[model samples]
Each structure stands twice: as structure tokens, then as C-alpha cells.
Target: MLDISVSAKLKDLVPDFRAGVICYHHIVIADLPQIIAERLPLFYENIRLSLEDHPVSAVEGVKEWRGIFKKAGTDPSRYRPSQEALLRRIGKEGRLHTIHSAVDLNNFFSVQYSIPLGIYDLGHLEEPIRITVGTQEDQYEGLNGRIMNMENKMISADRSGAFGSPIVDSRRTCVTEQTTDALQIVYTRPSTPAEESRRMIKKIAGMFTQIHGGENEWKIIE
Candidate 1:
């Protein structure tokens, strides 16, 4: 169980855009230990083999998703995949180091489903979180302690700080060992058909169920 203060705050932050969307799903999980033990190795191995067989092309579908965000008037740069990062992975034989359990789970799901996911540590967030586009001044510290480039981006944040990327969670709200609960938002571009996106969401949630012993609660938003 989570602290009452944190739980109440999480309840209040559900985004308005998430309402009535038939393609989006938010999944909450309670126990992550079992998830890590059962699924992490399989996910890592599958991702490694998949990348080895059909390596992600930096110039291909990488930018296709960006186009969707661009047409939506969101900053193309914020949503764009880092070409340097992609090339580096290719150069390194497409091997990725597994981070912590929660991070690994999210990364696995992203690679498997070709979708972006953001995980948040419920305890770290302040009450009344809001989902909105970022402004020129909005900034966040990301992986490796680097300041995120949020120029003209969108993010889910609260008075304390941002949690995810323009479409996912920022590192500030990332899960840790002490995390008792989490909220995950699967961002599906408008370009993908609603049915296809929903199917992908279910696949991801199903993986969570297979890994963690719990009944996940989810809702779809437009």
C-alpha cells in the first residue's frame, strides 16, 4: 500500500486529454519484484536478438513518428529520436544495458511494441499533477543527469517537477525500489489506427500481468 498523501495526489492528476480516448491505456502495478525476476531476462534476450536480426535504421521509421508529432504542432525536435544515439547503438552492435527493473520493463515494452512508455514513481510526485505541453522555459534533468531539451515540448508534470518526456515520463518521476505504486501512460500517435494502437496497449499490459501477479486496471482515452 502507498502512503495516503501520495495516492490521493496521483488520483487527482489524470489528464483531460486521456478522457474518452479509445487508444490510450494507463496501467498501474503494485509488485515489481516478481516482474523483474520472471521477465527481465527474457525481454533483454529478445530485444538483443531482434536488434541483431533487423537493426533499427536511424533514417527509417525513426523519423516517421516525429512527423506525427510535428503535424500535431508539437515541437519536432522534442519528439525526434536522437540520430547520434541511434547511430551509437548501431555501432555498438545494438546491445543495450539493462537498467533497474522498472526501467528495463519499460524499455523492453518500448522495443517490443514500437511504442513509447513512461513510468512514474507514485511516491515522488506531488499532488494535482497535470498533463500539458511544455513551454520555452520548461526544463527537466534526464538520463545521465543531463538537462532535458524541452524547447516547445509536451510533458506530464506537477508543481514539483516533470515526470515523463514530451510524450512519456521524465526521469524525475521514475520508479525506484521504494516505489509502491506506479502509473504508466502508453502514448500512441494519431497516425496509428486506433484499433492497432489499442491492440499494442493490450499486448504491453498483458506482459505486465505475466510478469507481476496482479490484475491491472486500465482505461482508454482518445
Candidate 2:
């Protein structure tokens, strides 16, 4: 069983933020072989092209700024463009290049479909994991114990704390060799219509199954 927990402080911070302002979703799966075989290469090519043509920006919302600015506190205005931006950029360029299998697969789907995707070790999560918006005082430990600024970021929380991110990931729920099950979370900004976002998610989910060859389960909530 996956052991999980969420910070009460974090949960309290959710409401003031807008839903779908950054369209995001989570996908949980049990294997990776097909992802390696088919999707990896395609994703690599897409990344290469994107890097060549459009210089990679630090994905807007992921960046840090002075305190207490926007109502979301983090300036949702400059937040990174949805995966749609990456895909459109790729289309304008031509083709892209592949990276490590895992990274490549993520970039490929994210760039193609226009959604931010985060994959975490399910084994590390507590069952019935939750998706919630972040709050002001909410914080998670990141690389080197650097506190992850959850202030206004949308997050995937387990029993422990924030595991997935719109900015960065927590060391506790990060993917590792020991990972057996995983949850792939995708975020969509408010600018995207719900219908369009759902369709894009379904298409990407189907592609994930086709390439990875695993039993898949999906859920979407607003």
C-alpha cells in the first residue's frame, strides 16, 4: 500500500486560486516498456526541434519572484504557456530530438499535447492520492532540503505532502529505480477550454497506453 499525507496548511490555501487557470491532469500507470520502445524517440525529436527554433524559457509559473504580488501571489500572468505553446512552437520549427527514454517520452507528449505532465512513483504515494491547489504557507522540501514554494502552485499531494508540481518536485515522491507504480499529472491553464483539455488528455492517455502497454486508470476533476 502507498503511504501518503497532506499538509493542512497547504489545503487551506487552495480556494483563492482559480481552477484550470493552468490546465493540469494526473495519469497513473504501472509500467514503462512500451513508453521506451515507441514514444521515447518521438519525444526526443520534438525536444530537439523546440530547442533549435524557440529557445527554452524557464516555463513561466516555475520561476520565482518577489513576495506577495498577484492574488495567486505568484503572478499567474507570467506562468509558463501550456503544453500547447510547446507543440505550436514545434510545428513552426519542424522536428525535435530525443533525450533519455523517460524524459524524452514526457517532453514528447507534453509538447505535442500542450499540457504540463509530472510523473511520480506511485509506490511512494498513499492510496487515493489527491490533487489540490496550493496555498501561501504551504511548503515541501525539494532538492537539498530547499523548501519548494507551493504558494499558489497547483499540486498533487499524498499523505506526506506535495509530491507533484507546476514548479518543482519533492524529493520524497520523485521517481526512482524502486518505483513500480506511477502517477503522471498534467496541468492545464484556465485559458484552455474544458472540452478541449479533456480531448487532449484522452488522446495523450491513449498514446501512452499504446506505447507503454500497461493497464491504465484516469480521473479528471475541476
Candidate 3:
């Protein structure tokens, strides 16, 4: 298990924050050529029912994230909730991207629970991973070559640098075809129930086992 920490400042800001971590070894993330074909409709129904008649922004999870962004001094509109972004796009487009088993599992958990998750290549991370606030000096590359400056924001970092957070993840630890071990991370805001976080992690672990040939070891670190 990795050593995890939460700062006093972050705890004050998000008192009810809950996190669950799952580390899987001997995992194989397949191309999953048939996964999208078989599961697209299920993903759609999950989102359609949850997002019924409500714009993405008004959903409670999205609203909580917006408040988190505002409190962290970032524009909420600019940094929309990551899961909400995925849900909005999938709900509108009615399609899911093929990123392989690990990535697909991540998105499935995210949409089902209305909480963003990070699936990282476990082999790439250093020990003693932590969660804390980012200062002005902190910066890392995010999705699609975007360099994110983590100022006044909650961040998850290893000894090397920040790799994952609710909003974005660094490219250094992204899961790809060769990945044999993965770390699934779920972060819940104050309004989210601890039970939901637990269920999300459990479900993700179960999927990973069924989809890929792997077993998972999990933890709930504050």
C-alpha cells in the first residue's frame, strides 16, 4: 500500500472528503475491441436516468465540484467537474471512446457514481503518494498536452510530482497498452456519502477482475 496524506488546509476545505484506492497486480489491459459494442447502451442508460432533465451543471455532484473550484480560486466554468464533463459529452453524443479496458473501467465508475476517478500506471509511481493543496510553484502536464498549474487547488502527488487529482491527471502515469499494474483512485467531495465511495471502488475492482485477469488490493485512506 502507498502512504497517503491529507493536509490540514485541505481537510478544512473538504471535511467530508472520502478517497478509495485499489492497486491491482498481474493485470492485463486488453484492447477490448468488443467492449464498446457490448456496453455502450448500458453506459447511456446510466447517464440518461441520472441526468434526466437537468443540465450537467445543476447536478449535485457537479454543483459540489463547482463550489470546490470557486473556493480554490479557479473558475468553475473553466474547470468543470471531470465526471460531469464525461457524462455531458456521452449523454449528448451517445458514444463512448475506446481507450482500452482500464480506461473504460475508469469512465464506467465515474459515470455511474457521478465522481471522477484516476487510473494510473502503478509501475510509474513512487512510494508515499500524498494528497494536499498545490501552491503557485507547482505545475504538471495534464491531458492532451495541457500544462496545469496547481495553485490553491487540491492535488495528489508522489515523490516525483503531482500525478492525479479530481480535475486532471499528469501524463506521466497514464494507463496505456503495456500497463500490467494499475492504481484506481476515487475522491469524493463533502456532499458525497462514504458508502458511495466504497461502492464505487468495490465495483471498479470487480470489473477489473472480470474484464482483465487480475486481483485487487484496496484501501480507504483519508
lDDT of 2 at 103: 41
Q: Write the per-residue lDDT of candidate 2 for residues 1-222, one digit (tens) a residue.
A: 222333353335433222221111233333456636565456646665555655444433222211112333455445433353444445555444443334446666666544566766665777565556576666878633788777666667766666766555687876654444566666554455677767766776666655544545554544
Give the candidate order by descending TM-score.
3, 1, 2
TM per candidate comes to: 0.66, 0.58, 0.89
* True-structure RMSD, every candidate: 7.3, 7.2, 2.3
The lDDT per prediction is: 0.53, 0.52, 0.77
Worst 10 residues of 3 by lDDT: 31-40
Better of 1 and 3 by TM-score: 3
Q: Tens digits of per-residue lDDT for model 1 on 1-222?
A: 211112222223322223111111233334456645566556556555665655554334345546544543565554453332433353355444655655666666655545456767666767565545556677877765778756545466677756665354456777765555666666554556667766777776666655543445555553
In what order do the candidates fall by lDDT, top score first? Answer: 3, 1, 2
RMSD of 3: 2.3
* Clash statistics: count for each candidate: 10, 36, 0
Q: Which lDDT tens digits does candidate 3 get at residues 38-130?
A: 876776766676666777888777787788767656676777667888878776776567678788778777776777788899899997888
lDDT of 3 at 157: 86
Tell me how many residue pairs clash in candidate 3: 0
State the displacement of the C-alpha of residue 204, model 1, in Å, after optimal TM-score superposition: 1.6
- Candidate 1 residue 72 Cα shift, in angstroms, is 5.3
Error in Å for residue 178 of model 1: 1.8
